[model samples]
Target chain A: MREFANKYGTVLVVGGEGEKCRDVAESYGFRDVITPGDIIKANAATAPFRALTESEIKNSRDLLARGGKLSDIVVEAVFVFADSRDWASDLQIMLDIAQSKGGRLETRSENFDEGPPIYFSHNDVLWSAAHEHVRLGMGALRKIVETVFEDVTGGRKLKTHAFGKPQVSTFEFATRLLQQWRATQHGLAESEPPETVYFVGDTPESDIKGTNAMNEKSKNEWYSILVKTGVYQAGTEPKHKPRKLVDTVLDAVNHGIRREMAKLGTRKDGKGRKLPLDDAALKAISEGRTPNFDLSVDPFAKAVAQ
Target chain B: MREFANKYGTVLVVGGEGEKCRDVAESYGFRDVITPGDIIKANAATAPFRALTESEIKNSRDLLARGGKLSDIVVEAVFVFADSRDWASDLQIMLDIAQSKGGRLETRSENFDEGPPIYFSHNDVLWSAAHEHVRLGMGALRKIVETVFEDVTGGRKLKTHAFGKPQVSTFEFATRLLQQWRATQHGLAESEPPETVYFVGDTPESDIKGTNAMNEKSKNEWYSILVKTGVYQAGTEPKHKPRKLVDTVLDAVNHGIRREMAKLGTRKDGKGRKLPLDDAALKAISEGRTPNFDLSVDPFAKAVAQ
Candidate 1:
């Protein structure tokens, strides 16, 4: 984000309510951040139908008080940090900036060739929210921006970048963080990464797909386990298939431990006998069911649980 | 509009700010009209991000106060009367009604097959407004609605009907109204319509296209004249060509009258000579320019102007 600021001078930050997105950008070391609210505050007619509340007006930074005319502020790039609270106004202001002459407000580029580059944090079209059904997310707004921009610009496509789940870079960053945590807390050597990492999530399109993609590209294994209870419906086949399917996070964890234990079956007890896995437990594991018996009661189960 | 209301029990009006759209529907004799604002006021969570103002809330009809549960109010059809003031909320609510089971609120249709039909008043993608450039009209909103609906519903196309310009029915209605006015005002026989109806408009996509279409189907001529002050920019060839191109509405009218006069050259004055048009005025008319002299001063021009 700082690199964008360094390259673009003043950047426009879209999404979130009030000054939330602007604060996030400033925290990332951006010297100057202009939000749609700021643009609207400077000129109410920018998005005529959308009226800012008194609090929103108060939250907005006055472009005139900052000692610069609204037209003088040239936004070189746009960063969408979160879902837009006011999609209409945000979309309008973003489109205005994207179509403006060298990113200047109120002036349109003749061929729409000089607008700023846009970046989004994520590209999930719909996400589970407080609403009964899934709500439109930042990805949906990104799609609208591209769509409406093309409509206004006579088929010129708006190029955008996203940096969240399903993107390889995001997965790589997560893997590096996990490795650092393992070295610091679990007594694992920094050089020796985990043999296999299990990822459990309810969204097949993002969580499962991204984990599977990372597993294909990375040195260590990334086993994706898709669970019910979110975007992925129970009875339907997901577009991106996970390595394993389970009913809950607890079941997924149990399945991973049982599989690892089976792989290490060759290692026996101190008496030189195979690890004591009773027939009932073995049957339960074979049938893809969590064992009914408490793992605490058995020595082998205790070792496997650890 | 009334026909739609007669067919569908309670229609949802999905545009205009506050009660503007609802009032239009009611004036057209619609017994019940439900705007997106009403739905939002009833259930704020329906479109969580869109917040209606106090006046907007007051303008909205309360579903609970009307003696029905929110879920029980089944919207049988959707009528978009004008440009949406709140695109985000309107889009969300419209989509909710569209994806609902039999248009019932808060219930998703299993396959999105049971939603109500939608109608748009006009399909102008961009319209000249108080703003510097063309603003998004009902057509743009319609396009977004269709695009987003497909995105959310997994490729099921949204079916919509539009009534205004470019549609053959609207032109036909206008022609009938013109004929009625001619009969009453000009004393023309009811059965004998005018030989030519000059349609002067600034938009080629809607006005010019509709007039040309009417010309193709009607016995009478409908000459389309395009003006430069709106959607159609000068120097570029329009996709829908007009019969005549001019600088403004006044110029369009002058050109039409000059063409009619030239066609009527065989008509003679009381002295048994061609109807008088002086050299300068004739040169100006031939060069496709409005004569510098006022039409009120010239006998021939006075007849045409009348």
Candidate 2:
């Protein structure tokens, strides 16, 4: 994540964690993290204003004001960062803007067949939650909205750009970030990406499939490791097989390090030499604790702080 | 249609025309005619009898009736005959019955994933009306309901049985009616079907395709004649090509009769001999007029009247 932020200079963190996630990203030296709310507000600001009718204005006691040209309004794209907390209002507002001409409220689009592009951060139909049963996720909501769009358009397919696990866009973005970070850190060519990248995750369907697909598409070697934690467990067949299977997160880290060491013909096990990654750092990551690092020696962290 | 009614003991007429269509069908010797209203009423009658609460009963001034077992209610199939007039209420009632346990209103299904089968008489997304442009039809309304159902069911696909001109069910029904009429008229065995049948229609996509498919599936031979009338205009390429194309309904009938006479090796023009189908009667039928028929000779009509 630090390497990604350093490469991008200003990273945008999109998720359902709201302000807390933004604060965390800022703490990690990300300066341009934004939320769906921010996008919605920006879109609303340029909305073509509709003046209240005479009767409505009178009822409002002259507090309502409206002065804006419809021609000045244009919404480039609408993004869904995460699963909405309030679906009805969120969908209603989005539908209004979608059906509006030039992003103008109260003005219907003359060509009702088309709408602005819609993007989503994730598209999981069902996600494991604290409850006994799985909860409906962002994908389910997207399906509902798509169905509604088809209905309103009299049976036209809705166009959408969805990203997250199992989609190529997020992996492409991540690869670009890693390449930029490597170039800034080691003075390597901007076009040169990492030779080998290991992605460790528990979910086989999304995480494994995505990494495998990205590996097939990209020039760099990509390996996926599955750990028996979170949603996945041992002795069960996975939807998408990973490159390595480990009992724990620590084991997954060790497996990746051993593979790299063997490939490089330097299998000393970090006994009398400084290693790029060690047990202490790997343990900290496995425990979900941010490891302490000296920014002076850590090129990625140093670049990120700046 | 008169010939069809004279063959079938009773025909179920489902549509938006309500009592007018029912009366017309009855006049044509159709003893059993059904509509959306009839289905709605039947479903409503079986709705679980929820006892009015204390305040609600008191508010009713002792006129409210209650105390019925929910087990007594069960709706097997739901049918949509045509475009709904009161969409909100109709949708609400249908949803209630769908989510109900065994069609018991107010009782949620334990499975939460299954529902009674839904049937649609027509599935047109839009239709030409008196107003300019196309208007929402029964099919459009069905799409909206299906979307809502998916939303409520957490992305489960709705089970639907739709039948219209383009669907094979309608064509099969038409063929069965024709066969029944032929058997009664010629004193042939019930197992016997016509050696050759002619289907004349204006629309190519619906009427022609359905007839062609039915012909492929049935033992009897079927030929389609396309006429330039109603929805099908001249010079437009049809999705489903017909066996013959004619300028008018009269020409279509003449074409079919000519082919039949040729096959029988008796190619005499109608002017010198009494033809099986009189031109005057065919003309009246083409103009949508009900011609007088001898009821004593019509077994189905006599059976229906009795």
Candidate 3:
């Protein structure tokens, strides 16, 4: 992922407590980062939409203290890489940018009601949390806020676009990212034919189905690898078997690329260089420097802290 | 109802803590009343199950001193008129009778596993209580106990049955009670052709639908009157509009009888003297003799006591 970002020149990942998102944005060498909490921390009227918990109040105060707030910033595009802990707040902030008068957060538009489509990464309605029952995801949260937005905006249909696993767009995005990453390590030039891209994912629903869905659409040679770590645990049968089921992510990353490369050796358009993770995925995800969880992005978290 | 009850052979009603259900059962002249609390007061664990509340414990002690203990007289039948407040302790006492190998509470059921069905008026799975959104009802509690019985019997189904608004047996039983009351009050008899019975009640789903369902099979014509006094308040649409909608129970009974008599005219085979509820229906459900409550019979006047 970092390799893809590095090859693309810059990456803008938006979400989290505005401070954390900003910090992440800075660490990743993005021109800027924004969070909804940053705006609410700057202003108070919008903060009372719900009863603020103590942590959220604290996050608000801390944001103001740091003086890194919602200011003018122009972003080309974004990767909604993960779930927003408080989608309502983050959504409001993101929507703020997507609809700003001149495609900027600071500027206002009389037509701000209709703006850029929200690029939601996933559409999972249910997710396993640290509880016996499943917790709701962005889809459900989107509903609650959509109702709020409808009342706030007098029944306007909010438009959104999304990408991420299981859903074809996210899979497409990931695959494209992989292609760029692979090409860069091997020093491939523009107008070059795309190489075979094999994706390894833990959950069958997200990883295998996503890759399959991607494979069905794309002309690029693709292989799917299923890992047994993150989402899919033992004791349950895999819903769909991939090319070869493996035990761990590390094993998958190592074995999957090797097998694909071996096959590639026989029918190669060009020779390849071995591109390894080498803590690069981790470093880029950490935004090219230290990742600080203390930089919590959710207003609710700050409300609770205070 | 009591007048009508005394007019007929005395019906004996029993069980439930204090005299709540007993009063209701007795309102229809179920003369001989008994409860496990009465038995427990005399011989602490003369039953199989043992559970009690603090107030019930004190009340039992008081009743013990007063000698209102379980009587030796045989009751013709038992009608659990409402939810049992002291379910575990009450269930223990009721089961003890069957366990006794005889009808006596003093005896133990050597073959209590093959006991009689403890009749309940309603088997609603859930009910509204003030503190919580929903609470478990006698139906759910019965399910739990029956689970115990199944385990004890190595998977034999408990001979458990329920009564009340939605349940057929209870409605049939109530219809019989009403028919008997009508007979004595109007000098009519079972020999007369069956009359159209109009049941006035709130709760469209239960009263209206149940009556409609029973109307499909029975010889008696069915007329329904839905009231807005209790269970259902005003301003909401009735799910099922009855034959005549009224504001109060008295209005319903008056309107129902008049409509039925008008529909039949002065020359009908099931004809009898006027069933003047203005004078008598009000008398049957009089505020003076009965404790004021939406439901939950009170023999000792606990809730309405000032």
Candidate 4:
């Protein structure tokens, strides 16, 4: 998140019930807040968007039963940050905004068909909330859109761009960010470059595949370090193998930075830093509190079935 | 074929334009013949229905166009026996007729999204017609209906039932017929059941899988015998193992019946005396004339890719 906020400038965070998502981003210095409910209320009567309950059946007394829609809110970066409280309403609104004919929710076309891509931030289709049962998240919405798109297009497959755990995109993006950061901190200039970037992740699919594909296709060498502290557990030796294995995030980060520095002839970890990654830093990230909530999902065991 | 006609009682033989398709089926003892043009002449308003070509592109005027729909033809049993000369017309017409509610012609409905169970005698998808490239057959027409159905129905995947080689339905029907024939030919009563119905085919997937599945699941047994002279080659080993490998149909038939007799308490070929599957007759069925048509675009292969 330190890297995220720095590189991407002031980001407007969206989606969350009454600012839970907004507050998390603001705490990380995002400095902006916008919610879908706010948008729907601010502009009514044309967006063709309406909110509904978790269950799909029409409710007589629902707020949206009286026909109104949202005005599109402009945000350069958007994320479907949390499990939606209302399934139909959020789906209708999010889909409306995402596919809003060049981003004007008030001016929507009257057809149920292919639409713009939604950047859902989390992969967990079901997560344990305060309730006894697991709650549905962005993944569930993603699956719904996928099915709906296909259904509307008469058997044509849905086109989507997804980037959470197990997807190659986010890890690749993160690695590129790390490469620039590591080189600048180590005083590497145009004439020099960092030799390697070690990706320390717990999931085998995304982390391992990212590193493997990176190793296969790029000049920025990355070593994969799979940690046992998160998504992947003991006993399943997946088809792809990581460069190294570790038991915890602190050990992974410490070993990763040190190994790269040693290999690159750099004198320290990220310019004059004599210490390995700090225990407190690792603890914060591992507890799912370090990076801005929009940038990262719960790092503990997420049921990312989608 | 004899059993199919008897079981169906009335097989409408279509596709012989100006007597070619009809000539072929009549030679095979199919008496009823109906061509598409005959229907349109009975109703002049739809004379344009016959104006379809196999490839209905705007500039395929050189491809002989047929004029008429399948709507006028009454068929208790259907055997689209040969490669279509004008697929666009045959396809549109057959599609219209098959989807007609309660088998009535000229009666339209919104639910053209599905059709009743239909059978094709030959499962040839593409075959050489003395042309340099493979030409379209009834299989191609079937595919067109499927594509259109998917396009109009909100992209719901169309579940079509097709017959011909490689579709288990056709082979299952054929094998059942063979078993009944065998039981009656032998002294076995209708109460006495089939032991094994050996299929000697030049194709691997249709013959091999059909025999294997039927053997595994049916009370009557099935064994696949591959011949090198047709769809399969001598050096090829099918993905699914056949019960026996033989270079010629004659050899396969001889082997299967002998093996069956060997299973019974007899060293004889069981000819004429209450059991007529002799070595000579087995050789005759195996040595019968095989057509020049292709049966290689097997449904099992299609299913595997799907």
Candidate 5:
């Protein structure tokens, strides 16, 4: 985000409540951060039905007041930092900018290629909330933006870049953070990382797919464990298969620990306590087969199923 | 809409600004009309970011107060009467009703087919407005709803019915209205309908397509004359071709009149007045070829082009 400051004249930061996205962009060294609210306040006609509240208008930076004209404030890039609170206004404003000439507000480009590039923080379509079902996320907005843009532009696609979750950059950043944590918390050398990292997640499209992709690229093993909770439905074949399937996170953890113990030819702990799995389960674990067991006592699983 | 009243328990009316849609539905004899704003007011948790104004909340009908519980108020059908003011909230509410069990708010249906059916007034993806470019219409919202519904529901399609232009019923109604107008205004007998109907429109998808379809079904000739002034851009081949392509509506009318005159075998009027078209142009018109003449002087063309 800081790198965009020198490259662009002005940047449009979309999404988030009120001016939070604008503030976040400015904090990241964006010299001029214009939000959708700011644009709507500057020109009410941009989105007729979507009107900003008094406080929202006040919080928004007036582009006309600063630049003397709406066309003068040319947005050079767009950054979607969070989920859009007002999708209609945000989508309209974004499309306007995406179709504008050299990022000018009121000017339309002959070819939409003259518009600024758009970047999204993440692309999670459905995210868990306190509500019964999953709520729409930034990915849904991205999809709508692309779909509407193509419709309006007559089949021209709106290209966007995302930088979270399933993206390789996000996974690489997580790996770096894990290495730093291992050095500080576990007193392990910086050069020496774990032999295998178990990633337990319920979404096959993002979580399992990302982990499998990272595993293919990384030197150390990235063992993906799919749990029967969240987006992945039970008794259905997942699009992206994980290394192991488990009923819960606890089950995934127990499976990994048992597999590691079996490799060391051990059944009991140093305290002489028996392991959770029996000889048959231990043999299955050693053979790289998921041991069949009844572990459906997870309380949260019922809530997700409902 | 009136037809669905007695069959369905409750009908959810999505779109329109404020309570305008609800008022329109009630005027059309719909006993109970629930808007997305009403649903949001009943449960703010339904759409977290989209906050209705105090006036809007006051205008919205309280479903929980009337039914005692949110789940008790079931929406059996949905009708989109106008463009949505708030896409996010409307989409959420519509999807909730679409996925609910017997249209019950909080209950999820095992097979989404148990939910309410959706109907759209028109499926015009783009419509002319005061704005520079064409704005998104109910069709775009319909596309988005279908897309998001499929994404969330894991590939099940949302079935929707439209009642406006390009639909066979709408064309049939227009034909009936035309016959009534001819009998009442022109003093022509009801059975002695016109031999041909020239439909001049700027949109190929709806206007031209509907006229062409009506032509195939009607006893009279329904000639579709598409003008390059709105959604149909110049120099590009339209998906649905019209009988004749012209510059403006005036050109379409002139073309239709000259062709009729040629059919009557007359180049001059009754008072020795010569028609605007030459003999070669009139012959070309009779042969169904659009006369190549200068008709770009239409003032509205420049504004639409801009």
Candidate 6:
């Protein structure tokens, strides 16, 4: 991602882990990372749409004492990467910023009645956790905030952006990241990008739909293969059909290799070259190992701080 | 309303002022009343979904020391009459009660995923209060609780009752009250109830829509009169049209008297008999006098504490 941004332009990142995400992004050589909390802390000096009251000043002092930053904040967009840890405070601050005058706190905008466009990276309403029941995810929180916003604005339409699974943005980002890696690591020419990419996953809705949507927009083709190891059980019908159904990732890999070789016109005696899954890779697969395909724009150290 | 309740049967009341409203209703001869706060205080024993913590015990001791009552609480329904003074605590208790097993404190229901039906009497998101900008009203707080509930339930449909202003429930209740008043105070038989009622108000949506909906269902008729003394201003389109638009409540009364007299075939020389508006009534209307329509089952003394 760092190389991709360097090659193309700057990459703007946002996350839910407050300052930790920002720090991690910075460590990975990616600039411009922020959270709603950062925006609120920056606006602490001017809040409640007037000269700061004594109590407001005292609260600001306390927040500064507890390690808040002061800066001139201007928000062009908001991208939510995960479920907010402090939803009440985050929602309050975001609403304030969205309703402020040109993103200035303590000042009412001429167009303060309308909220700004919001984006979330994922659409999982409930995610499995260690608890007995599923925990509320970003999608659920988004619904709550949307409902509150609608109520506050007297049925004003709420405009938002949804990415990640079943959306094109995440897949596009991942594809760009892969191209960047190919160019920077393997010295591939920029003009000679891969013609097609295979997306293999166990979930039909997010993975398959995202891949298909990206394929519709991109010049490159995306072949989505559904595996039966995770959410997709063996006998269930998939919500979004993939290019092929496979029992495991190994089968997906073999299928992709043979198809690509055949496309390259490298068939010999009506057979294309196939890639064999090595013993180590088979053992890892048997042990429930899968490659970490998500390219990190941050470091593990910063994630640990959260 | 008290006479009406006495003649017809019983009436249950609820309010935002908790015990104060309850006391007022009792004083007015009402038999039952409940508030969201009362439900919370009653469930203080089973808070945070656990046994009473040490802090809880200490808080209970302090509340008792401060003249709080000690009584076993049982709640069949919750009604919000006005803006809650403490929304966080009120919401927490309400959610607990709604999720509790058979509404029992400290016991989780096997079917806890579905929340109880919540109701709010007013839907004014923001109202002119003793402040500069509008203060958050019962409607705004209700939206917050609803959002929280949806988030907790992972987008399960929210089942609720919204009364007051344009909703059928408040109008139905008011109509019943009027019927009871006619029977008890005027010695009118149940079969001789008024054929038509004149509902005079300044707010268009709440007053007019409620009357219109009630008229749709009732065998008798409801004539809505919009007045311009309060929320409704002159030269503005009303959300709900009224039978007569007037400058004041006096004009509304006159209009209703003339219309009803004509309906009774008592017009003489194309002129109908008029109801006299006495000096005191005129002065009261000019001075913006409105009856305290909110029936309180709680005590006035407790409301004063608030």
Number of the predicted model whose TM-score against the real structure is largest: 1
Docking class of 2: incorrect
Superposed model 5: Cα runs more than 4 Å off = A65-73, A227-229, A245-306, B66-69, B246-255, B265-306
Model 1 CA lDDT for position A122: 90
- Pitting candidate 3 against candidate 5, the one with the higher DockQ is 5
DockQ of 4: 0.01
Cα lDDT, all candidates = 0.80, 0.57, 0.52, 0.51, 0.80, 0.56
Q: Give the per-residue lDDT digits (tens) of candidate 5, residues B71-135.
A: 88888789998888888878888888888998888677777878778899998877766566666
TM-score of each: 0.86, 0.39, 0.38, 0.33, 0.82, 0.51
Q: lDDT score, residue B198, model 4?
A: 75
What CAPRI grade goes to candidate 1? acceptable
The CAPRI category of model 6 is: incorrect
| DockQ sort, best first | 5, 1, 6, 2, 3, 4
B-chain TM-score for every candidate: 0.87, 0.56, 0.47, 0.54, 0.85, 0.58
What is the Å distance of residue A299 in model 1 from its true position?
Answer: 23
lDDT (10s digit) by residue, model 2, range A79-115: 5655564343344445545665655433556555445
What ranges in model 2 sit over 4 Å off? Answer: A1-64, A68-74, A110-113, A166-169, A176-192, A202-205, A227-241, A245-248, A261-306, B1-306
- Scanning candidate 2 chain A in windows of ten residues, the lowest lDDT window is A57-66
In candidate 5, what are the lDDT values of residues A44-161, reduced to their tens digit? 7777677788899889887777748887778889999987887877888888889899898878887777888888888877766556666777888888888888877778888887
Worst 10 residues of 4 chain A by lDDT: A52-61
lDDT of 3 at B187: 67
Q: Which is the better candidate, 2 or 4, if ranked by DockQ? A: 2
lDDT of prediction 2: 0.57
Task: Record all residue pairs in model 1 with backbone atoms less than 3 Å apart, i.e. clashing.
Answer: none
